[model samples]
Target: MWGTSRWVRRMAQGLVLIASAGLAGAALAGPTLTIGAIVPQSWPSTAEGEELVLGMQLAIKTWPGQPAPTLVIKDSACDPRKAENAARELVAAKVDLVLGSWCAIGIAPRVVAEAGLPFVSANAERLPKAPDGVLQLGRIELYIVEKLAADLRAATGLRVGGRTSCWMNFEPVLREQYDAVLCPVLGFDKKRWEQAEATFTAAHRRPFTASVARGYAAMEAGLAQLRRIRGGKSASNDPIMTIFGPLPPTDVPAQADAMQLVLSPKLPKLSPRDQAAVTQLLQTKACTCLADNSCSKPGPWADQPFVVRGNVPKCPTLAAASPR
Candidate 1:
């Protein structure tokens, strides 16, 4: 009876060793660290929020040298409450870093950061004084609004350009929260811009005019239309010739308008087309910024192309700037 018991004990010990070895091998084969992504899968205009997942995937593809982090994606659908719940789950999962809520669900990364985890946020431009481990990316709305004015003026030769701006205070604040780069460029006093916006708003509508604010596009398009109807020769009628304004009023489009540029709610990172748009605006004999003398010395905002490179669309303004 003693001999039989000893044999059974030896067998059990061997089995345990094998199991432990197998588990170690599996751990070695799997990702050493995990990254959680909280994003909106649906609701609240899925178009902009959908890029949250894609951007992280792109980041992963770019980070081969770094210890490849395992990505776990959770959908918060741009909801604040659900995002908090998702944050708790990720914390429980013991993720090393988090990327999420590309569209201003401020609580998601705050939870991660509070947990002392590393996080990268593509949005929530108003995210204030995050913990040391957090980094926010992109530009803001004032720059876009300001650039819109510049681009329109440069393109159309209209001194005042157009106003399709949603002039409410929260609207600009919301725009600022999404972008950081525009912090340097946004005018300190937007009162005149606001007054212009009011004048424009009273006249037309803006686009994407949703729960947050009115659209700047409605007034923009209306100004274009009215200018054309009036048969005025100032380039504002041509839109393509002007560097318009901070923003005008807008009406939502029949089809959702394609995002013309990426914003940070704070700064402007001119997209290639936007750069070209601004550059072309400069070429239109309407670029007042260039006349400021500082611009003549190849300052910033130079090297912006007016046409999408490798595609030659007819921009008479650019042709005019190109020396014959």
Candidate 2:
């Protein structure tokens, strides 16, 4: 009876040790996801760079369990060569995924695809097909084209054929399908785009434009994908599909015909306060200095009042817009 009792005690101890070891292993096996980003950190797009970083940082912090990703960011300076080099560095760092440039994205795709890394572009105008390993998260082509076409018909009651408009900015293949009247331009509905831009700028207190908004939207899309990644699955496992849902629309100011103007529905929504701010901003007259002057040089628009001609002060616009 004594021997049997001693043996039973030894067995219990062994089980306890085994269980402790298993727990320790599980604790040490925490997931570590690494993500890399490339942006124009130098002159021309510095505000954009800051906004992009803020968006990604916000997304990561709000994720549950504080599953922080190791972020490696590089400056593209809005240059294709610089973007390519930055991508190569990210690939070398062995990041699981990549978020890339607003300006240089057109050229950066080839580098990302060669590295077999999954990527999201913050401001790509054109969409990409599968197996390309890249996704355009904001300001996508199809949505903009359709919306522009609809707006034109409403404005002119006729489609402008073979006309060099905003449609000209799109690829030849895409433009061919829209041989109608008055294709939308980049700021197709300038009045509406300005309103949306002002609203977003006021809300964020940063210089917001369509491209910057696209950068923010791209980060949101990336965060959504990161949330869906199952544990231990390869990050390369899925293709980034376009989220085709409409975000809440920002209202365009009243027009001659009361035609409702809005930014592309492809964009994500801004808050209610932001929408109101945009409405207020649209009431003000355009500032000649803000519109024509370059912010690249100091004191260009420094003396201008914050509330220009009854419009609430938002961030000033860039001198010359960067070409993506």
Candidate 3:
């Protein structure tokens, strides 16, 4: 019996050693990239923050890779101090990249950049001039403002101007005052959007919003950078430059398109004549003369408040309607 006990003890020790080696191997084989996210977890923006995190999670879950990236999330609580603190925590955790949303707007980017981590401002409308380490991912307000002005001028045949406002606080009364309003349209492929919606709804039991879309796009960009690094295809040895450098063109269409002009849904509808005029104007082809260089000479439209790029469809109707 004593000999049998000794043999059993030896067997147990051997098994323990093998298990330890397996665990160490697994740890060594774990994910190479760790992504950190700073988002609001408390206060008024809690819902948006949660949805954004969910979007990031969805992106990771859907990634088709051998070793998936790890995600570490910190809460900013929509406060400047908290955002800074969250960024510091992520830095201490040694994350490879950092993504920030609404609450992380101002200080978080600076903190992450200073820590030598690439910071992606997922929802910033505008970013101050900074080093390449800090980059923005979403549409800037300047584009929205310019697009609105151009659309209004094209449709109304009148000189129009645009100013930025808090879109979230936009009221129907303001729509009544303005001749045109710009609205965001999900620029994603219909099938992809449906899939995302279904997945988001199932997970969160709530409708997906633009905040979530931003989060999803942010993660997608981060993973793309990681892949480039792993493949040794990065343009620069510095990860920050590699991440913030001009992206190579891909066949995939943009997930979000430029803002689209839409009539306000305010009640007490417009008069019949006004409504018809508005409808006709909207149906008219967008003025692409400025974009396409089809115009015989430069016009006032060329003096846009902000720089606009890409060719628009030729605007035959606007040309014909223009006062020659």
Q: In lDDT terms, how accurate is model 1?
A: 0.42
| lDDT (tens digit, per residue) of candidate 3 on 1-324 | 999999999999999999999888876555567899887766556766677788888888877764678889888776778878888999999999988755336678888888877777765344545445665653444244566567756645433335423232111123345544443322344455566778888987887666676577678777766666566665554432211123223222222223434333332355675455443443333343445353444434333222222122333322111011
lDDT (10s digit) by residue, model 1, range 1-324: 999999999999999999999889876454456767676677554643443344344334434333455678787776778888888899989976666544544577678878877565543132445555454432233223356446544543333221222221112222332321111111212443344344434544532122111112212222233233234442341222111222211221111111122222222455676566545433332233343343244423343322111112232221111101
Model 2, backbone clash pairs (residues 3+ apart or across chains), number? 6
lDDT of 2 by residue, 1-324 (tens): 999999999999999999999888766555677888887777465765676676565445545534477777888877878888888888898887788756555567667768877687755344434235565543334234355445434433333232232221221121333323222223123443354455555657865544444544555556555555544443544543322222211122212211112222122244675454333333321223444343233332232212221222443322112223
Give Cα distance to truth, residue 140, candidate 2, Å. Answer: 3.6
**CA lDDT, candidate 3, residue 217:** 67
Clashing pairs in 2: 159-181, 160-180, 160-181, 160-182, 166-184, 166-185
Measured on C-alpha atoms, candidate 3 has an lDDT of 0.57
**Can you tell me which runs of candidate 3 are displaced by over 4 Å?**
1-33, 66-68, 77-81, 124-130, 141-186, 189-191, 201-206, 236-257, 260-324
- Which regions of candidate 2 deviate over 4 angstroms? 1-30, 128-130, 142-216, 227-324
User: Higher-TM-score candidate among 1 and 3?
Assistant: 3
Candidates' C-alpha lDDT = 0.42, 0.49, 0.57
TM-score of model number 3 = 0.56
Alpha-carbon runs more than 4 Å astray in model 1: 1-31, 47-50, 65-67, 124-126, 139-324
